[model samples]
Every structure is written in C-alpha cells, then in structure tokens.
Target: MANPKRKWSKARTARARSNWKLSVPGLVECPQCHTKKMPHKVCKTCGYYNGKVVVQSEEQD
Candidate 1:
C-alpha cells in the first residue's frame, strides 16, 4: 500500500477545508399563506403548492 509522501501543510489543509462549508437551505414564499418554505414543496402552514391545495391542513386552534 502507498502512503502520503509528505504531511499536508496547515495552509493547504485550511484552503481545502474552506470549500467544505454548510450552505443555507433554499427557500421560497408560499403563495397562499405567504410563509417561507422550500421551493416546489407544499407549505406546512396551509398545505398548498403552486396555488393549489396538495394536502388538507388542519385549522389552528
């Protein structure tokens, strides 16, 4: 088996790790409820998508 010829430098390791970052989830506003939600997904608050009710949502008490 082959091994690394030399240890990775701190700067090089940091540069490589800099690209490994957490990205914020993409969000869109629900047309019916005006709440933030993931794109192309139903709105939890109103159970709607693309101006249509995909799921029946329970009314808030």
Candidate 2:
C-alpha cells in the first residue's frame, strides 16, 4: 500500500472548502394567494399549485 508523501496544507483544504456553502431555498410567489412557496410546489397558505389545489390549508388562528 502507498501512503501520501505530502500532508495536505490548511490553505489548500480551505480553498477546496471555499465553494462548499449552504444555499437558500428557491422560492416564488403564488399567483392565486400571493404567498411565498418553493417553485413548482403547492402554496401552503392557499393550497394551490399552478392554479390547482393540491392541499387543504388550515385557517390561521
């Protein structure tokens, strides 16, 4: 078995991790209810997706 001849440096490791990041979820407004939701997904507030009801949302108290 062969082992690594050179140890990985901190700068090199950090540079590789520079692009590793968490990105915010993509969201869009529902045309029917004007609520923010994930693209192509049903709006939880109004239960509509692409002009069709996909879920029954409960009334907010």
Off by over 4 Å in 2: 1-8, 58-61
Task: Please give each candidate's TM-score.
Answer: 0.64, 0.62
lDDT of 1 at 40: 79
Top of the candidates by TM-score:
1
Predicted candidate 1 versus true structure: per-residue lDDT over 1-61, tens digit per residue:
9998769988999898987866887898888878899997888889887777788856743
Which candidate has the highest lDDT of all?
1
Candidate 2 residues 1-61, lDDT tens each? 9998668888888887986776777889889988788897778788887787778756632
How many steric overlaps does candidate 1 have?
0
Candidate 2 overall Cα lDDT vs. reference? Answer: 0.80
**lDDT of each candidate versus the true structure:** 0.83, 0.80
Model 2: per-residue Cα lDDT at residue 49: 76
